[model samples]
Target chain A: MADITQLEAFVTQVRRDIVRQVHKVNSGHPGGSLGCAEFLVALYQHVLQRKEGFNMDGNQEDIFFLSNGHISPVFYSVLARSGYFPVEELNTFRLLNSRLQGHPTTHEGLPGIRIASGSLGQGISVAIGAAAAKKLNNDNHIVYALCGDGELQEGQNWEAIMYGSGNKVDNLIVAVDLNGQQIDGSTDTVLPLGDVKGKFEAFGWDVVTIEQGNDIQAILEGMESAKTKTGQGKPICVLLQTVMGNGVDFMMHTHAWHGKAPNDEQLASALAQNPETLGDY
Target chain B: MKTYIDTGKKDTRSGFGAGLTELGKTNENVVALCADLTGSLKMDAFKANHPERFFQVGIAEANMMGMAAGLTIGGKIPFTGTFANFSTGRVYDQIRQSIAYSGKNVKICASHAGVTLGEDGATHQILEDLGLMKMLPGMTVINTCDYNQTKAATIAIADYDGPVYLRFGRPKVANFTPENGSFTIGKAVELQEGTDVTIIATGHLVWEALEACKTLQEKGISAGVINIHTIKPLDAAAILKSVAITGCVVTAEEHNYLGGLGESVSRILAENHPVPQEFVATQDTFGESGTPDQLMEKYGLNAAAIVKAATKVVARK
Candidate 1:
């Protein structure tokens, strides 16, 4: 088990990396990236039983697929901090010829990323596939995927959701970042994802919810419980109720910061809130 | 002139089934996923033999494509089977992002391709699949001519790394290729040798090109036939060699003249050896409900069409 204080410090550092990377590029998705910092931190640092180092074929290790790849800022941060790559590489996020693309991809030979996902609603299906592969190999490792709530509107997600549970893809856990905000506006105004929990349940998934998704302890607990629900003949769905731009005060609770980079002054303010816990990249 | 024999008539999908069944027995890592077309795609044997390795994705081609891409992360070679239309157009973005862009080893096995899919009409018969797949960077686009070649290609793609689009058809065509032939990717097979004109074709059109070659030989045209199974990473060398000797070429395929095998050959020739060329392909039109032969004849994708194009191109030369 990871120490609570150490995990909290890691979450704070990830938040700093998210803001810094997006601010450095002056382009990227910071809202969702900032929102899921703690969850991703918990996942990599503690939750997932991953193998040492990185290989393209994650044969016996726990694999994660980021369906909402716009959140590459936080994902790259967590992956780097987890020793998948050098922490300094986070500085190259979305830069020309950088391994850290605008969206997470295995194309550039990025260590942690398994699939390319930016065009939404593809990750859950891919996770189901990896889980199925694990079952075939008798590896018995769980596959995890994170998706956006707004991304659920893509019809492919429903198809994948139905297939996952219908086919008893029980060795997978899909987490939906239910921040309730998209690029345009709140999900309610854009396209209401009515009762996301009910929707997953209707699709035959075992649904769980983390009321405080940004809280490191809560995320760790929820993920631990979600892990226990695995291998029960139904895929798991975790509705992570996070605030958009979670750690930063002004950026939180709004869709304005969804894909926009924070200005110079705003970056300083965002950095102030996060603090230099593990040193800036 | 070289001669060939027709072993029998069989649908290329059956060949896919046979290959997949063979893979199930031989390779434990080879997994199959079908979008509710197990019987149509002829994946039933594999499904029955290795129930655990087969995934019935139930009418969701996009999700199936995503899953196939994901499966590759764990070193599992995934073969996604579906109709040509649903396989390419319906899930093109899924394949582009998840499989091709990510450089995953996924075999996208598409059956019931071209107008010869027959009664299904234009909605199901995808004439642009070859073009759609070939345009993607690093995607290996293959259109097998007969049952034997289709089966051999299916098994061959498992060993070959990276993304592949293997197109076959539903109707019983002339199964002339060797039963256990060595299927090489990006290498054109020369069926006949001549100097008057080169007849290059793919998929069902390969048989038509061969038949046209026989007709041309009767007329003292002495045409050469080359079966170009792989369209992308095209055998430019083989095409150049054939066109260098023949001085003119006629490209045939069950696809549109634009962006199909015809255009690919034209580009190769224009860059290296500019030759008088004629296309024996659909002229940018969708097909309607009809028998396989009727559709082939109406679309000018038959041997007679190839002969007409060959004669015209030879005259131009």
Candidate 2:
């Protein structure tokens, strides 16, 4: 295992990247990005077995799709730091004529993204397709997907849930960023995702819930458990219960921060909580 | 006029089944998914023969579309089988983002298209499916006339690496085309050659156009019949050649006169070759619950309608 200190430093720098990118663009969903920074760091640094460079086709390597692509801040930050693209390009986050848009997409011929996924609840389906493709090609590589808990309210997600488990898509590992909050309010207030775990279980998926999705160790264990559960003739779903804004003090536990960016002072204060480790973009 | 004979009446869905099974035997990457409509979609053969590749996605068409788009990521050629309404309109967004926009190699095999879907009424009968699918960028839209053509299109779409919407009907109709005819996209098949007027048809209307061609010939009206199987990436060369000779056109389809094959042809003619054109299709009205024949006749999609359209176009010419 790598040093916890180094991992923490990486996660911290990822958050800094997210803040700097979103703050510079003055647009982007920062809440979930910040909240899921540690989880993303843990997955990229430890959980997933991806290649050093990002390839769109993902021929022989494991693939990951950000279904809730609005949380692109965290995704782009993680991807850039993990060596998908240049760290400097994160500055173009929502800029006109730049590959980096407000949401993650393959439209701009983005090096890492294989499919466009700004439309919520569609990523899991794409991930399942990728996993199925892996099985067909005899690639044996796992496919990972991350989606927001609130986005699960889309009927499309349930369709994916049913398709994945029904087809025995066990090569896929799907994690729901159950921050409990969305753009409007708490998930219960917007739409009660009643018994999400039970729902997935009933749909024939192997369900795993991470109580501390924001913590590196907890996220790592959750993912490890998910990996062990693969190839069991059932798809896997991990309910990651994390704070809406994970690391930043002012942004945490608030729905307002779900898609909102922090001001300069707020950005400075947030960056103070998470020290630069991997060097900020 | 071109002389055409019907071998027999067979549901186009059966042709899809036969083609899918044939694909299974030849290609390992060919996978099929049905939204709990395996029997209706005639996918039983594929499911039974290639159970490993066949996926039953339950009643969720949207999810099924998304999954099909996803399956293409790993280099699997996925064919999603469902009614036209569910395949295009119901899951357009899923198809838009994952399939068309992402440029995944997927075959959206839609059965029970147009008013010919019959008895299901307007809810299940999607007259706008052709338009909906054709409007998407990088989408190849095709409507096969008979079982032979449906089978050919199904097998052919598997080879074409892009998003394709292959539309066919549920009812049994004419099953005569070359059993092993080479299917080429954007190439119109001249069923009959004449100069008085050009009768262009797609889907079930191809049979009607053939029948109309015979009737028009008996009436001393030399009508040229062209089967435009591929609606998008339209065969401009064939259409212009036929229209150039006839100087008038009659477009036939079991779809809405608006945004149907007629409109597509009109748009092409308007831009490239100006010609007097008539449409044999459903006016802007919803289909009612009726037998397939009754619905086709009521919606002005029968051979008699095509004959009338040919007469009018010939007169104009």
How do all models score by TM-score? Answer: 0.99, 0.95
Highest lDDT against the true fold, candidate: 1
Candidate 1 local lDDT, B1-317, one digit each (tens) = 77678888999999999999999999998999998889999988899888988998888888999889888877899999999999999998999999999999999999999999999799998989988999999999999999999999998999999999999999999999998999999988999888999999999999888888888889989898999999987999998898889999999999989889999998999899999999998999898999999999988999999899888988997
lDDT of each: 0.91, 0.87
Candidate 2, B1-317: lDDT as tens digits: 44567898999889888899899999998999898899999899889998878888788888788778778876789999999999999999999988898888999999999888888799999998898899999999999988988889889989898999999989999888988678998788998888889889999998888888788888999888899999998998999998888899999998888888999999889999888899998898889899999998878888899888878877775
What's the CA error at residue B33 for candidate 2, in Å? 0.9
Clashes of 1: 0
| A106-161: candidate 1 lDDT, tens digit per residue | 88998987889899989988888888888887888889999999999999999999
Q: Show the colliding residue pairs in model 2.
A: A35-A246, A129-B70, A129-B71
Q: Give the range where candidate 2 chain B is weakest over 10 consecutive residues by summed lDDT.
A: B1-10
